[model samples]
Target: MLRKTESSIIFIQQLGRGLRKHADKEFVTIIDFIGNYKNNYLIPIALSGDKSLNKDTIRRMMKDTSYINGVSTINFEEIAREQIYKSITNNNLTELRKLKEAYHELKNRMGHRPTMHDFITNESIDPIVIVKPHKCYYQFLKRINEDISELTSYEQQVLTMLSLEILDGKRIHEIILLELLFQNDQVAYDDYVTTLEQLNCRTDSNTLSSVIRVMDLTFFVAAQRKNYGDTPICNLKDGAFHLNDDIRRSFDTNETFKDMFLMSYYVQRKKQEPMIVALH
Candidate 1:
């Protein structure tokens, strides 16, 4: 098959036409001559029928097809595999057009506006990709002209900080402390370390201090600080960390802002649970 089609569905349909069984045919030889196309990465996505938009899964399917349910084989030349890898790396999965398409498709499937949690639960495109282009999911909805509640300038900046930095689940210390503060209004450093220990996370002094810095925006570079409006999510005083007064006020007064922040936190916590289990 000529690898000229940009649509994965069309590519898969073309491949399907040749896979029909014949009276005398034992098997069919399907040859795909890949070209230097930007969407060559979609070939594996089509063959594997994986809609996760996960590059690693695509790469794994290229490497091994033995786990496939049917008695079929997929072979890729080393050079061709490398070409697909390059395409996956260089292609912007978070481009506006792609994000909009994914959003609408998933929205249609659910018969309603899909939340970030809905995407995660459905194993659809990575919600991070949605946030990358617009800094938060609501902003992306806004860009697509979805009628949603508007966010204030301050609320928008706070969401940007959470989406860009905290919600990636690189480390859960900040999230844990933030959740604690939300529950109790303050968290002692000792209590924070104890909580990390209970979760099997690194409780080293440096790691603890780093979490504090991250929450207070001290860990970010000047440019990043400016992007987040130089706002601190937490404030430390008397050896206890408290949510920043302005932020806490926003959360207490604005139900919409509170809901968005808590939803992001819940998603991050869910993402970290697997790592926490493995640590034990």
Candidate 2:
């Protein structure tokens, strides 16, 4: 018989492999296999990021659910107890106390059932390139001098502006412009034009579209566009132009790079969000 920890780890490794096989993308998330949460017993972990319990972890403890869709019935209580046990076994005294305190601190917080993290463990692919581009990235933007550097002055400005706007994922051109001004709101075309002028980039919608098109053609960026609201939005992919601190650090440190690389790859895979194309 396998030890509980060993059993749970095996389950996790299995699920990890399953996710990799199921999804075209390398990174995996709870959302991919969450069609039937309660029956599947993957709900809590998907919702919460608690490290204690997760679907695979629970699966190991219970080994009951049929990984089939259209199941006829389920013994919810039995699985629920398995989830509760995992939560109890996984945590230390301090966390247990916190869980209990949180239970009473807010009435119905537990919702007559085990909490989210109690049922599932929250796992994520770590970041790839860890870059603190704010300083060096922006310094390249501060000076407008044209001839004395590696990246052209134009490229530097655009890259800095892009870094400042997006924290985790990519956005379309209009969305990027909108963020620079209204930040998640609508901005008059005039204000947007002024901002672009100040940056030495053209404000015309057509020119901006061309810039994106050219970048994609050159492999300087990879983007996927989708419709959002009444407008189209574009998002960047984990391609060459994108720079991440975690990824950069991994490459710099010979010893830690492999592990960090996997983690960063995971982060990039997880962060992909749906976006609309930029319509000129």
Candidate 3:
């Protein structure tokens, strides 16, 4: 089909007409010209009937056409694949309407509100992206008018910090240390190093200290620090690290916030890999 279509349903409908049986018709050759379009990523989603909305899944589908079943085959030129990859990477999946649609779709499927873990497990848009435009997921929900509990200012601040700094899963040291503190309330510095060693993560002093600085907001510039209220989530004492008392109390009292925070960690844990440090 030579027609350009933005909607997967319309694209499939157009292709379906050409696949219909006809008298004396042996085989049909379909050629789709992929121009410089931003929605080129939808080609695989339409072909595979996949609604995961994950870029990696779409890329894998492009690489392997075996999912089509039977003797039918599909192929893409190298340049076309590159174009689709660019489209997938450059398209903003976190647009407000798109986010709302993804949220409600999952919510309807599960018969209740979906958590960050739900989004991760469903292979929907990354939860980190969902929380990007707002202060946190809670704020996003509020923007969509979902029924959610009200958050105190402190609770909002903590969630905002977690969303902005740690939810991306880029560097996971802060997540590891925070999880340790949540489990034990306090963790010795030596024990923390031992934990990293056991996990095969980098245990150098510089890396370890940087983790603490990030959690305590010392790693950020002043302008960036203002976004998180210029407060530390953890404290370093003589020989150990401790979760801030107010944050700890909030974690204990606010089950919703605790669930969201732990859900973020769970999602990151699935995406986490051992940190590789170079020796100079």
Candidate 4:
């Protein structure tokens, strides 16, 4: 039998086959793709891509519960190709042809594989989970998602970003912002303004508004606009958001930021689904 990770990759390949066909046909060359993965679900994102496939659209599409499940990423194209070819070589020719067509569609839509930066940002990872033989991997993943629904999209984004920062030790805003922007270099004042608008945050200026919303009183001290000559400028709390002892300490010590929310999400999920274990 394939490993859990391999099964996840296969499932993603299947889903990508369907999505890639309808996706816009263009090579979205980006500095990075801010992909988020939880359990088996991999949300591959292209920041500032075609307007229709922008961040907001991707977020909304992912909110659809159906597509949110059984998603994963395979970062190695050759590995993906090898897997596909090996599977097809021994399978029925008709099914092989169909799989090939879908594989081509995915290749055309998403290009090759994701970069190393992509894995770090979204916390897309392979963490081992202990389970009984009867308990399928997808079932375990679904349970994990069910345990974390109280988290808003903004909150989830913040958590994932924080997770990455913590994993990387320390990260800069310009670097983070650029990673978030991914494919686009020409960021304007409006980009900041729009992110704030989506989150319904209030602030004195566009410069610090989006930053304020992202930090959400959980991790940052402040984001403020200051004048730099004739142009508007903003400073993020410190030089950059540090993920060393201070930040990690906060997550461990603070209730509102981590433990309380996690407990609530987990407890409520368990209470509502008492028979889930038996069902599994």
Model 1: CA > 4 A from native: 18-29, 52-73
TM-score of 3: 0.80
Model 2, global lDDT: 0.34
Please count the clashing residue pairs in each candidate, in the order shown.
Answer: 0, 25, 0, 1
Give the best candidate by lDDT. 1
Better of 1 and 4 by TM-score: 1
Query: What tens-digit string does per-residue lDDT give for candidate 1 at 146-203?
Result: 9887788878888888888877758888788878988888888788888889989998
For candidate 4, the C-alpha RMSD (Å) to the true structure equals 21.2
By TM-score, highest first, what's the ranking?
Answer: 1, 3, 2, 4
Report each candidate's C-alpha RMSD, comma-separated, in the order given: 2.8, 19.5, 4.7, 21.2
Q: Identify the superior model by lDDT, candidate 2 or candidate 3.
A: 3
Using Cα atoms with residue i matched to residue i, what is each candidate's TM-score against the true structure? 0.86, 0.21, 0.80, 0.18
Ten-residue stretch with the least lDDT total in model 1:
49-58
Per-residue lDDT tens digits for candidate 2, residues 1-280, read 1222223344455555635544456544332332222233333332232333323444443444443335222234554556555554554422334333433333244344222222221232111111222212223223322122243333333333333323233433333342442222234445556655654545576776554443333323323111101111222243212233332333344432333223222232233322221222
lDDT ranking from best candidate downward:
1, 3, 2, 4
Q: How many backbone clashes does candidate 1 have?
A: 0
